[model samples]
Target: MAFFTGKVALVTGGSSGIGRATAVAFARQGAKVVVASRRVAEGEETIGLVKAAGSEGFFIKTDVTNEADIKTMVEKTITAYDRLDYACNSAGMEQQPTPITEQTEETFDQIVNINFKGIWLSMKHQISQMLQNGGGAIVNISSAAAIRPIPGIHLYNASKEAVLGLTKSVALDYAKSGIRVNAICPGGVKTEMFERFTKDNPQAADAIIQMHPMGRVGESEEIADGVVWLCSDQASFVTGQILAIDGGFILQ
Candidate 1:
């Protein structure tokens, strides 16, 4: 049988990058997928890709930072699938690289609201729905910056570190309830986000690639594969852990 033959999954930020890839992964594995994002067009594109992979998929316009939107997302999932089997909290934003001393309050708040609070809000609604269904799996997309500081992107680094903490805390609090929570710390992946980061900072991009002992940037699909495994029965015993999908970057 397919690993996720009858599962249902919700992927936040599913319009692009890691979230988009993960959404496609779930659909390919036979899960009914709900791809949520702020961009309707991108969300529709993600749904098309999921359908091409031979799974049922739909798009939901969502802003993860909004409580009402998150609540609506959870409601829609339950109404459509009757249960929430898995959720990937991949919605986030990275601030423009700026020295700490020069960072503006507006940028800092925007980063925190979307990257940190967004995940928290997603978890809040998703967990509640999962509880009604007996159990579920959740994966939050963190970053290598969570463990190691990135000099210019201090705010981004801090937000991801908080994601790590949130993952562990949720895992412990809900283990007995049959809900598994984990986080993935991905290295530089060749996504639109990475491309944007590198557009003006070629040197930064090159240095990042060099740090990865694997000698290349990671692919979004590669990180998505990890998300699939974590949500599958194959990872039944895994919880409260930070899985780094970096190309050996953490080693050195």
Candidate 2:
């Protein structure tokens, strides 16, 4: 039997890229998925992918930065699935590269509200539901920038770093409560976000790609695979780990 058979996974930011891939990966492994994202159309498309993977799922229009929206998203999941077994907080935004002096408070808040606080809010509600189940796993999507400093986008970097710290703290807080919280720091992955980050400077993108010891950026599926593993029984003893699924980008 599939390891995830009879399990249910709730994935935020299910609209595209790593989020969509992780949801489908769970489906392929025999789990029912609940996809949530602010993008209704693309999120629906992800539900289609979940079905195509031979599993079932539905989509919720969710804005993670909004507490009420996130609460409703989890509420609806329990309403449908009757139990919450796993959650992947994947919805987030990226800031354009800019020096710290040029970065505004607006940009800083935008980055933290989504990348860091969004994860916190997500865990806040997800843990409440998970406690009822007696146990569950959660994976938050962070970035390699969290630890390794690049140039601009300090806000993004700081938010992700904060996520790691938050993850470890929460893991200990819930250690005896049957909830395992973890985070993933992905290297440069080929996604719409990456494209947008590099659209104006294709050369810069190429340069970034070559920085990886693997000589290329990672794919969405590769990172998805890591997420699935971390949530599986194979990782039952693993929690609060900042797993780097980068293509050896940190090696540099």
Candidate 3:
């Protein structure tokens, strides 16, 4: 039987990058998936990819930072699938790089709102839904920045660190209730966000690859694979851990 046959999954930020790859992965494994993102067109593209992979899929317009949008996303998922078997809170934003001393309050707040509070709101509603069904798995897309700070982007690093803490708390609080939560810290993946960062600071881009002992940037599908494993029964005993898929960046 397919590992995720008859399951239902919701992936926030499913319009692109790691989120898009992960959403497609779940659907290919036989799970009905809900792809939510603020970009309606891109979100629909992801849904189409999921359908092409041979599973049911739909798109929901969502802004992870907004509580109302998150509530609607969860409600729609339940309304369509009856229960949520898995949820991957991967929606986030990366602002222009700024030194800690020069960072404005507006920039800091924007980063925190999307990266940290977004996950919090998603967990609140997703956990509630999973409880009704008796169990589920959740994987939060954090970054290696959570473990090792990037010099120019302090706010982004701090926000990811918060994600790690949140993942642990949710895992512990609901482990006995049959829910599992974990975080994946991907480093230097070749995504639109990474490309934008590189475009803004080419030197930083080169340095980033050199830092990865593997000598190449990681791919979105690679991170997606880690997420899929974490959500599958293969990782049944794992919870509250941050798995790094960073091409050996941290080791160096």
Overall lDDT per candidate, in order of appearance:
0.93, 0.92, 0.93
Candidate 3 per-residue lDDT over residues 6-109, each given as its tens digit: 99999999999999999999988999999999999999999999999899989999999999999999999999989999999999988666767888999988
Provide backbone clash counts, one per model.
0, 0, 0
Candidate 1 lDDT score at position 245: 93
TM-score of decoy 3? 0.98
Whole-model lDDT, model 1:
0.93
**In model 3, where do residues sit more than 4 Å from their true spots?**
none
lDDT score for residue 82 of model 3: 96
lDDT of 2 by residue, 1-252 (tens): 676989999999889999999999999999999999989999999999999999999999988999999999999999998999999999888888897888898888888998988999999999999999999999999999887867788888889899999999999999898788899999999999999989889898998898789989999999899989989999999999999988888878
For model 1, residues 1-252, the per-residue Cα lDDT tens digits are 668988999999999999999999998899999999999999999999999999997899999889999999999988888999999999988766788899999888899989999999999999999999999999999999888777789999999999999999999999999999999999889998888888888898898899899999999999999999999989999999999999987788
TM-score of 2: 0.98
Give the worst 10-residue stretch by lDDT in candidate 3: 93-102
What is the full ranking by TM-score, best candidate first? 2, 1, 3
